[model samples]
Target: MKSITLFLCLFTYFSASAQESCMTVENIKALDAQWEEKNLNPDPEFFKRVLADDFVWVHNHASMIDTKTSTVKRAEKQAANEGSDTRSRIQSEVKVAITGNTAIVTGFTIVDRGPTPTRYHFMRTYVEVNGTCFLTGNHTMAIPEGE
Candidate 1:
């Protein structure tokens, strides 16, 4: 009876942990969707809630930007682009690996806009700080054709 109880306890703990990990992945996925819909729509409050203060974003073009200021700047730049006026859709296949309070998410995003389509493979690392999940770093690479 004691062994059975111990097994049940361990199973419950692991099951709860697994659920939490899944929730974290879903949160990150939702954030990606929010970013895709309108980068400008993410407020500073949201950034504070989701991104680490020292977050570094590495763009596919090899430009590196700080998350805090760059979040707004990126939105502004996107707004200025002619492509902003066109409707674009992004689909991502995200795989998240969680270790303690930190998580790494790697995925490929395919974006379609009118007659053009682009694909980006990206990896983002996130950490839980002060009881909130924050994006710490990111790297993106463009996938060549025929891969």
Candidate 2:
């Protein structure tokens, strides 16, 4: 009877731990904002911290694809040029979903850096490992003018 009781207690504890490990929407939203900030500012350290080693990003209707290394390199290059980036981004219609240790965030963003505003629909995937969240995948599609 004591062995059975011990097994039950262990099972319950593990179950609760699993539930606690799942990422919440609020958590993912905050993380998503960090991603947007990275885009706006192109900070290499922030990208390094949030992006997984094998992260992949499909940018703007497959115009280009970038890996974690490439993304960091691009940020470094951008950072080298002083006062070049003047982009401002606004995110809307954002939604987040989570399954166990993984989260998916979808949103629309309008960026004003050129003569006119460019809009995009984007999705980001994040995974929690050892209680830390890392961006694993990203895909974005540009919305054409007037629609």
Candidate 3:
């Protein structure tokens, strides 16, 4: 009786864990863009939902490390300033990999703020819990002003 119960418990645990699935690369990419664009309109609740509690972002030029709270505050402020007005981010060299419940993505973004576009290289990490994915870390570096 004890052996049968232990076997059943282990099977139940593994079955439950296996049932949990992560988001696809395409889905994750869309989600990333959505969260970033939210900065323009600044949805505090959405930000809270998309970002992990310990989220961290390393800025490009300023090299400032931003926590989740600070990033959300900046987004709110940006919305107060009438938003950035940049909606299109053309991504190049994009790649996304998933391992278990975590995903790592690397890409370059061409930000079209005006006639002259700026390029940035970025790597972002996400993790899924209970079928929901959240951004955990983001590191970006400005591509030098040249080809």
Cα TM-score per model: 0.64, 0.82, 0.76
What candidate 2 gets wrong by more than 4 Å, as runs, is 1-22, 83-86
What C-alpha lDDT does candidate 1 achieve relative to the native structure?
Answer: 0.67
Give the true-structure RMSD of model 3.
4.8
- On the 0 to 100 scale, the lDDT of residue 51 in model 1 is 62
Summarize candidate 3's per-residue lDDT along 1-147 as a digit string, tens digits. Answer: 999999999999999987866578987888877765675467777887889999999988656999899988877777778776676677778789998889998988877777777798989999998889999999988787875
lDDT of 3: 0.83
Error of 1 at 72 (Å): 1.8
Q: Candidate 2's residue-wise lDDT over 1-147, tens digit each?
A: 999999999999988886674378988898898788777888899889999999999998688999999999988888887423657989999999888889999989898889888999999999999878899999999899989
Candidate 1: how many backbone clashes?
A: 0
Runs off by more than 4 Å, candidate 3: 1-20, 85-88
Model 2's alpha-carbon lDDT is: 0.88
- Quick one: best lDDT, which candidate? 2
Each model's lDDT: 0.67, 0.88, 0.83
Candidate 3: clashing residue pairs, number: 0
Between the candidate structures 2 and 3, which one is better when assessed by lDDT? Answer: 2
